[model samples]
Target chain A: MRASIVQTSVAVVATLLLFYPVLQIVLLSLNKLPYFRLGGEFIPTLESFQWVLQQPEFWRGLLNSLVVSLTTVGILLALSLPGAYAFSRYKFKGKDALLSFYVVFTQVSGGLGIAGLIALFAIVSALGLRNNLFALALIYAAGAIPYHTWLLKTYIDTIPKSAEEAALIDGAGVNTLMLRVVLPLMAPALAVSSILSFIGAWGELILANLFLSGENRTLILWIYSLMSNVYSVQWNRFAAAALLYSIPPVVLYVVLQRFLKRGLAFVY
Target chain B: MRPQWLILPGLLLFLFFNIWPIIYSIYISFTNANIKNFPPPPPWAPEELKQARPPPDFVGFANYASILTGPASSGFLGAVFWTLIFVALSVPAKVALGTFVGLLMSSDRVVGKPIMRALLIVPWALPLIISVVAWRYVFDPTYGVVNQLLYAVGISKPPDWFVNKDYAYAAMVVIEAWLAYPFIMTVVMGALANVPRAAYEAAYIDGAGRWAVFTRITLPLIKRPLIYASVMTAAASLQFFLVAFLWNFIQLYDRFMLAYGYYWAFGSPFREYGLAAAVLTMSALLISVFMILAIRLAGLMRGMYES
Candidate 1:
């Protein structure tokens, strides 16, 4: 009983320590004087949130973020669905090598540093796609595929081969087996990947800033530029924007909470 | 039907978007491909592929040699060293803290395990830049809550976290560990469940000490998860940019790390693509070396669970 009490206290302490800073941001958004008054000034106001709402760019950025994030999720599912099935089902010779390559591939998560990306952006533009959300989504999806393919493959592995064999024996073609037979079984993993891919594209700053500009700015790029702006950077506005910017991801987390627990239970 | 065909779309995407970019990035490192040299037009402005200018002159290893021995040499070295230090500090600390928390969660005594698990994901799930920006405010010197709290505790004359090197380093690492530890904790928690309760009971029946049981049985069982967490965290830390980018905005350039070094090359009015690419190429090489060493040391590749 004493040990249990101690463990419970530890859990509470960990949660408090983790959430306190986030709490401060939420509070700072409510309070007007973030800089002038450091002590607990609980005077709540929505001026900053209102101010962010007034800015046309914030909404535009949100829309662009949604577009890019959804695009990335679409592309990732399109590619990883088939790729994962092949890895999980096929009896290929070089399967282990390919999987190993994908494992090492996750480490290159930086996705060509912003500087290198700038150079590549030049080429991408030359190919007649510049500051395009779809173009940026392509890059985002490409970056996500290697790790996610490996991830979804592990999920696919958990489903017994008997189902696939049974489907094949029913005279279903490979495409039908993948689409009709296997995809239904992958619903939970697909949700997990969708949430992850969406979250990644939404939060990504370096590539968004490096690739998209002007009208195509993602929410993070807008938030970053707002903070970096020298003339006028209100802490209240910064706090408000950051909090609002985090909503899609937090909502996704809450909505897909169940899938993530099972999907992430074991990652290979 | 050829099984290989299913992989072709994924392969083409990887080749075109992933492999081609790296190859071209390396090629650009050899040449002077800065915007000043080959400026792109405004986004709204349309430009045809036929109108795009020819590539710049290849300067061979000049960029690499310059970054190694130029006026920017020491700054680059500082960044690399700090990157290594940040990784070295943050990864191990996170794993340790994560193991403790995971073990805590694994205990039957811990109540509301599901709620704790869900709450822990907040740090990881919240957008990273938001978290960094929030921390930036938290570390503010004058009206910052951190300073206020420190002074209230009678530690007057608290260090300005952003300006002070040691404080900034500590602050950055702590924030990273805070964000990262939960991930390791989750992975460890999952791994812990895999360790059969019977195994522990067996050890207990044998009258083994707590430390002996953990060291001999628990450690071996969770080795794969530990290695996975270590490699992922190390690689992420080595390419650490977002926090550094925001933190260094107010701080000096020397305190910056490798990723920012790459950014600085391009951030300046006179864009230096070759030099920036040199820094990038080096950063990628550094991260790859770290990942390879980690895999070699921990045998992480052996942990890949497949059908």
Candidate 2:
């Protein structure tokens, strides 16, 4: 009983510490004032939400973000499905070498950092691809390939190859075998990869900041811009926009939570 | 009919977008590619301006020299030192705190586990920008709850978080730890589930204490996942950028390697892309060396190849 009390106390404290910032932002978004203060006015209003909802740029940025994120999911699945299929099923030359390279490089890819940004900036501008949303999606998709391919490949390795062998023996081509036999069996893994890719592309800012401009700005960029001026920041409105912007990813993440450990275990 | 051909599409995209950029970045690191000459404006630009800012010249090792032994060396070196310190301080904090919470939550003694878990996972699930912005408010110094609580406790004039360097650094560490612990905790919880219940029963039957059981039995079982998380988290710490950049880029840019490289590229008036590339190249090399050492030490790659 004593241990239970101590455990409960610790759990409560930890949960509060983790939830405090999120709670503050939620309250700030509903506060009447444009800025936040600990003991200031307590009048509640939806003015910030109204203001944010009324902006044309808000809608445009939302559309742009959706387009980029969905396109990323599409391209990512297109690339990773085949790539992981090849990896899981074949014993091609350099198979182990390539897989090792993927795992090692992805681990330290953060090291490469934004070193490539300069060249990317140069190349995009020179090719008239600046401010192009699709081009931006291509970049996000490309960066995710190494990790997601490995993730799905690990997942594919779990399934028995008997069904695929039967399909192959029945005269089904590779495409039919994959789409009919493998893809359905791997729906959970596909959902995990797709949602992860969507969230990544959705919240991404650095490359988007460089490659995009007015009207092509993503939802994250628009919310970030709200806080840019700093001196005249509308904390309430920014909070509202941020909360609304965060909804899709948060929902998708929660839905994906059950599958997260299994997917992550393979990668991390 | 070849199965290998299936890899072509991803390989092509990866090469064009990923491999090509690194190669291009390396090539430009050896050239003087700055705002004046690197990215020529769209074709609609003025003819004279285009002619004025000609193509980048091959500066050879000048950019590398400036970063290594030239006037800019101090900033680069300082950023590297602070990044290492940040990683050292935060990774352990995140892991230890996460492991503690994971053990607590996994205990049968803890009630309302479902609700607690749903609440705890919010930090990890929400988009990062929201959390960072929210943290900005919490540590606002003047109107924030942190200072308010400090004042209530009879302390006066807590240091402004973003204004003071040390305080800002501390705040960054706190936020990074908070953001990352959820991931570590989840990983720990997963690992814990795999631990045999019989081992714990045996330990208790033999008159083992809580600490003894944890130190001897639990630690060994969970050590592999913990090591993996630490190394990955450490790599992430080395690449810290967005939070610092968002919090106070001007003051904190010199405190992180990537942010420092960012300053050279976009923050500086000269737009020294070549210098920025060199800085990033060195950072990449450093990170790779660190990762290889950690992986070899931890035997992390053994599991990957086997799986």
Candidate 3:
């Protein structure tokens, strides 16, 4: 009983320590302190939220994030499903090598080699695709494919080959087998990958900052820019904006928590 | 094999955007191609030659030489040192804390295990930028809740958290540890659940204390997962740009300047592209060496791979 009490106490302390900042932000956002002073008495006010809502940039940035995230997810699914099926079902040469490549590729830093990517972007711009959202989506999709394919392949592997074989025996075409037999079974994996891809594209700062400059800034970049200068560092407003920015990813994760767990189980 | 064609689209995309950039970055690291020096003037114009070209001249080894011996070298070295400190401190703390929580969650003594696990993941699931920003607020010396709480408890004043380098590094370490521990904890918890209980029972029957049982059985069982998590965390921490960049951008935007800043000022930020590439490539190489050493030390990979 004593040990249990100690464990409970420790867990409580750790959890509180971990979340103190978030709690503080929530409090500050709710309480409208007259001054920016840290320890001043505060009264509740909706001024921060009011300010946040009035900013057109906030809504536009959020929309851009949504568009990029959703488009990236859609493209990831369209590419990963058929690709994962082919890799899982076919005993091709260099299969192990290809698998290893994808795994290692994801493990490597996506942002590490941005300069080369910027150079390539220059080349693409020369081809007249500069500052295009579709181009950004394609870039995100390309970066996401390795991990998503690996995830889907792992999920597909768990479904017995006999299921697909039986479908084939019933005169199902390859596309039909993939569409009818494998895809449905892979829904959990698809959901998880989609969520991961969405969150990744949504929260991504460096790539977007690099590629999507000027009017094309994502929500994260916009929020980051708000705090870029001391003159613009309005704590209340930043906190409110942060709360708004954090909502979508939080909602998505909550909705897809189960699928994420399953997907994580497969990957790890 | 018609289905094989489906692989081509994804593979081609990956090759173009993913693999090609990596290769291009590696190649550029060996050159002196700075974006600032692009569109060089006619070669015959000696007067134009005197003007600092925006695109970097093909000065082989000059960039690398500068990186090692230039005035900015110490700062780069400092950044590397601090990064190492951050990783070394945070990774072990995370592993230890995570394991303790994992053990507690796995044990029957703990109540509300699901809630505990879920709470642990909240930090991990919170978007990193938001979490970091939240941490900045909490550590805000003027109006931060930390200072407020401390002052309420009779402490007269708290130190400037992000201003002083030591405190700044400490704050970063704390935030990073929080961000990372959940991942390690979840992985360790999964491994702990797979640990056979009969061994612990037998140890208890043999008059073993809790510490002895944990040290002898639990630690050894979860060794592989722990090593994997440690190495991955180490690698991730070494290349940590976001937190540092954000923190510096927030606190010392004017004061802090590096090679990247110089490039940005000149309007051809790609001047330091080669150096940036080299930095990451070296980091990857270092991580690979560490991973191989870890795998050899753990000895699990041998069994799995040999089969």
lDDT of each: 0.77, 0.85, 0.68
Model 3: per-residue Cα lDDT over A225-259, one tens digit each = 88675356567778788888888788877767676
User: What is the C-alpha lDDT profile of model 2 across B1-307, one tens digit per residue?
Assistant: 5657877788788778877878888888898888878776657778887788777889999988988889899999999999999999999989988888888777767888889999888888888888888998999877688988998998887879988988999999999998899878877887787667788888889999989988898788678878878887888898888899888888899999988888999877889998998888888778878888887897878745533
Q: TM-score for every candidate vs. truth?
A: 0.89, 0.95, 0.86
Q: Arrange candidates, best TM-score first.
A: 2, 1, 3
Cα lDDT tens digits for candidate 1, B162-272: 778778878988888888988888777777776777788888889998899878987876777778778778878777776767776545345545554556555567677
lDDT, residue B280, model 2? 81
Error of 2 at A98 (Å): 1.0
Pairs of residues clashing in candidate 2: none
- Candidate 3, which segments miss by more than 4 Å at Cα? A1-3, A34-42, A111-121, A124-128, A230-233, A260-264, B2-4, B38-56, B70-72, B146-158, B195-207, B249-271, B274-281, B284-307
- Model 1: how far residue A123 lies from native, Å: 1.6
* Candidate 3 or 1, higher DockQ: 1
| Interface DockQ of each model | 0.50, 0.63, 0.43
Better model by lDDT: candidate 1 vs candidate 3: 1
Q: Against the true structure, whose TM-score is highest? A: 2
Residue B161 shift from truth in candidate 3, angstroms: 2.9
lDDT pick, better of 2 and 3: 2
Model 2 spans > 4 angstroms off: A1-3, A35-41, A261-268, B40-52, B303-307
